[model samples]
Target: MRTVTRARLLIVCLLSLRYGGHDEPAAQSHGLFCASADAHPTPFILRFRKTDRAVILPAYLDHIFDAAAAIERKNARRYLYTNNNDSWEETPFNHPSTFDTLALDPGMGERIKADLDAFSKGESFYHRNGRAWKRGYLLYGPPGTGKSSLIAAIANYMQFDIYDLELTKVSNNADLKSLLMQTTRKSVIVIEDIDCSVKLSNRDGADEASEKATDSNTSCKLTLSGLLNFTDGLWSCCGEERIFIFTTNFKERIDLALLRPGRMDMHILLSYCTFHAFKKLARNYLGIQEHPMYLELDEAMRKTSIQLTPAAIAEILISNQDSPDVAIREVLAAFPKDMPNERAGNVDGGKCQLSHNESKQQTFRQTMFVFFQKTKHLR
Candidate 1:
């Protein structure tokens, strides 16, 4: 009996070894799996392959791998991004057909046209070493001289986004750099009324001393060197394909450091409208090719001290767009009856004078400003 029991126990041990040996090789050591509650008693089990530690909780590892894979898939093609604090609002900018179609001074118009053409062809006059693609325009003159209008015309012509930098909103050079970086390519960066934005440093010391004497509590965050470095320094090279436009009511007020050669690629003197400019405005606003008053208006423009700005002409034309005759009549009505011989000889008057044009330009500038402000507000 004892011999029979020993033989039975040996048979049982042999069967256990055979089953365990076959099971070890069938379990997989390394393979991923997602857990499903439907699977069985254990939340996860080893995928069948020959290894230990193959089983893992799908919640612990599967979700992490899935998230990583998702991120890689989403960011596969994006390369550029721009961010700014200013609200992204669309402002209507329609290029005035009259301004483009009319012939002003052939010489000035041709030069401006050539420059704009070059810009359209992707050629920058200042950049030499394949770095820092920027163009600067210094538009300086008295108020009511079509400075802002020129900006609008340029923007409309180029179809470029305008990044109107409010210097007061910028804290310092770093802030300025960040703002510049946020501007996309094929855009214009404008700093209008720059003279008032910051207290500029002066090399002559006279201007600096004068400013110091006048205001003691003044604190200037932007210095001349700071501005120069921002525009021309190596840092400016970070951006490509952009235009920098600076407009000031008084160029003389700006330090020479700001206006040195290469700093301002172009200095557009938006003076009062000449006889040529007036005729062009007429052709544009009023479609009268050959009016009876054409020669008289021309002679009047040449001889009369009355000087109308393009802005004033635009307002008169806009108000009477329905009737070219009314626009022409209004323009002539605004002119003085007696043309000043000396003033007429000078295309642009030196200072404020009692001329028909002077009064018209003043009124035009104010009215346009209000118009633009309202338009901007609406937007």
Candidate 2:
């Protein structure tokens, strides 16, 4: 005979047991068995005490949730903080930038990679020192010097998602903290153009401060104190294994309080392009291991130090890549034609090798033109 039952009765009994009621079991006591389509075993949850919670809740979560699955496969995601219904919106991040591909000095790039590796593996060290498991990086460089690309490379190398926090978009300190709270572990919190993001109270401009000054509820002023708290305060301990990145074009504009070693940590300067960086670009663009023009390029760069940016130089290489010889000459031309290095460029004791290079350049241009004409006719 099937006996009728009610959910209220089950809840009443469970509540009675949970609240220390010594009610005797009903004669027709029944047990609830919950199951799912998932194959993993689900532990039966009966009590409401924290002891049971400590033992069983996390085990249940571990069975169902896999936070590190994507990270293990080197496929992390990117998240942007938003002021809409949700705090952050997520998307798959698959940036191809790596240490090898960056147009940065090889030595500097390697050191940065090593630093990232050490931080990722420094869980024990952080815990031992009684510090939160977070690292801060300050990338300061002029525009087009690959600050954004470096961030992408860091994310790819570390296998961590990027959480790009826009301070200007945030209404106030409380909002900022809330946004940080929603961010998951093993993620990068990047604030690009920090100097341009917000004109905080401690910095310049009384007019800007007056504009930001408003009721805390409707429009709260985001202050330097709040930003510092977001970086290193108790509220910042919401998650573990986070990375904070602040990038700026003008480091001088930023307040000193934010640039301290513990707060900003490593301050990396992505300065103007070096000849070593040009070689990396050549390898990537022209597929060349060695070239005579390499010496000329180096000599030209060394003469009073050409301040061409990596992006600007890379553009020349990328555009003229079809003709490698022409590309090399163009890059050399980009630098000042100061006296040629005797050993590197010229054979006749430090005289300019313009005639020789011009002759080669003319021949290559003719060859490309002839080849293109023939191909055009054939087509």
Pick the TM-score winner.
2
RMSD of each: 19.6, 14.3
Per-candidate TM-scores read 0.60, 0.67
Q: Number of clashes in model 1?
A: 4
Worst lDDT run of 10 residues, candidate 2, spans 8-17
- Output the number of the lDDT-best candidate: 2
Clashing pairs in 1: 27-49, 28-49, 306-357, 307-357
lDDT of 1 by residue, 1-379 (tens): 1222221111111111222333443432223222333445334332322232224224424655666655664443322222233223344444453237543454765776577767666655435546466777898765666676666666555556677776555444566666666677767668888877666555333465333311332433444555787677776667766777899876767777777755678987766666677777667767666677767666666665556566666677777778777666666755566757564333334433444455556666556554653365378
> What is the lDDT, from 0 to 100, of the residue 51 in candidate 1?
33
In model 1, which regions exceed 4 Å deviation?
A: 1-104, 120-131, 202-220, 344-379
